[model samples]
Target: MTVQLNNGFLKQQTGNTIQIDQPVKLLVVNLMPNKLETERQFVRLFSHLSLDVAVTFLRMASHHSKHIPEAKLQQTYATLTDVYDQQFDGMVVTGAPVEDIAYDAVDYWPEFNTLLNWRHDHVRQSILECWAAQAGIYVDFGINKRVIPKKLFGVYRCEIDQKTALTAGFNQLSMPQSRHATLGHINDPRLAVLASDPEAGPVILASKQTHSTYISGHPEYETNTLFNEFNRDREKGLPIQLPKNYFSKDKPTNTWQRDSIHLYDNWVHSLKKVKV
Candidate 1:
């Protein structure tokens, strides 16, 4: 998706005179090979928020990216080695298309594990999405990811577990998810379900004690995200399930893509307010 940002949103302040609160520097660990798009997506999500957010992109140095342009990576992303022991107010680990492989089988698993452990100790809060969420469960609590019989693709409705701080302002909000892996068969004692579907219950959200948040869905997806993915996979002859309830008339061309800025904003705000 081509993203364009409005310069009007940025306010000019003289730093030589005085500076206010420090901008919340977030280290976005993008497992998605397309570093350009991932960076733009994150910037788009957090740009509208009132908080000051500065993002630094981190990519796995061990795995060679095939989807993203090599030039883009050299220009925009940094390897995991570039950021170690650096304190970040927030951290994000994005999902990738590597769910088909075993966690340890992935080339960067060792470095990835190290990054996750560091986040647990340093970052105030962390967000894990889709496959990353599943991997996190495995790394943190020895939980495993199970392949479902079918791909759970679509705009699913999640009923909020109102008691949690993450759901403080959101109740019965609809989120977007496009993935083939699930955690239904995983046995993990530390995992907690913050919201669930009536049909697919136990979509884990947050743990009891950790500041990490796991979202099985891609709440940050653009309106055309699913549609684009569907077409791409179809062209590639990859087996992909249709996104259920994504189109207004259940037609691919009629899908109305929308932003999840509100949800993203709420999450960032919640992280700031959450006391560890």
Candidate 2:
């Protein structure tokens, strides 16, 4: 069956959408403030996949999101308890703008921990992004994120390590980074750096034992995402700098689009070989 997508580029993808016996079920923990926009961004990539896939957006029940109305969240998003008995082909815990604060201090941290623990047994493959990456690593591997003096904001070229199923096609790719912290030297023998940059540190990390992937940057970001963020901070009279390698003339080029799509596509295709 053909699935209708959210909006914008996603709407045009209906014709090209893949048909299969069963869609790969994916659970995404929506930690970003703009839920709808994040949906559009991710669904856009999922639409390009060679197999059918279904995405379920999950939200934290403990914390009240001030940006989007609670009424809307309840109508669409699932809570941790809602999917406790369900099994998924893959899971993704997204990044949030809570890098400066300790993980336990966050209002939803307790429940977030519960969800993370659940992911291992119930989900086939899992990915943690940005702040979530730090949290997951600390919990699973005891790797703590260190705060940098300045926010590492902008597009950066990351060198891809020896190819794995998840990063097979690319040697090196440019991904956007927007964070206040970075993963320090990884001493754990199980954890492998799939991609890294001198300035951005470890951008993509993976561990076979955990069956999880961690991405430190925003590869799924829309071309204008960093641009919009920079303008917003500047307008609020906050300390902000122009993103490095992001602008040509006046607009930002989408340097990471192909790589981001490639990464997600690989993850979806690998689902068949994974057992929940």
Model 2 C-alpha lDDT versus the unseen true structure = 0.83
Give the per-residue lDDT digits (tens) of candidate 1, residues 117-142: 77867788888988899898788777
Give the winner by TM-score: 2
Provide the TM-score for each candidate, comma-separated. Answer: 0.83, 0.92
The global C-alpha lDDT for each of the candidates, from Candidate 1 onward, is: 0.69, 0.83
Cα-based lDDT at residue 109, candidate 1: 93
Where does candidate 1 stray beyond 4 Å? 1-21, 68-72, 185-189, 250-259, 274-276
Q: Model 1, residue 172: displacement in angstroms?
A: 0.5
Among all windows of 10 consecutive residues in model 2, the one with the lowest summed lDDT is 1-10
lDDT of 1 at 89: 73
Residues forming the 10-long window of minimal summed lDDT in candidate 1: 6-15
How do the residues 186-241 of candidate 2 rate in per-residue lDDT, one tens digit apiece? Answer: 87999999889998998899999898999998768998999999999899998889
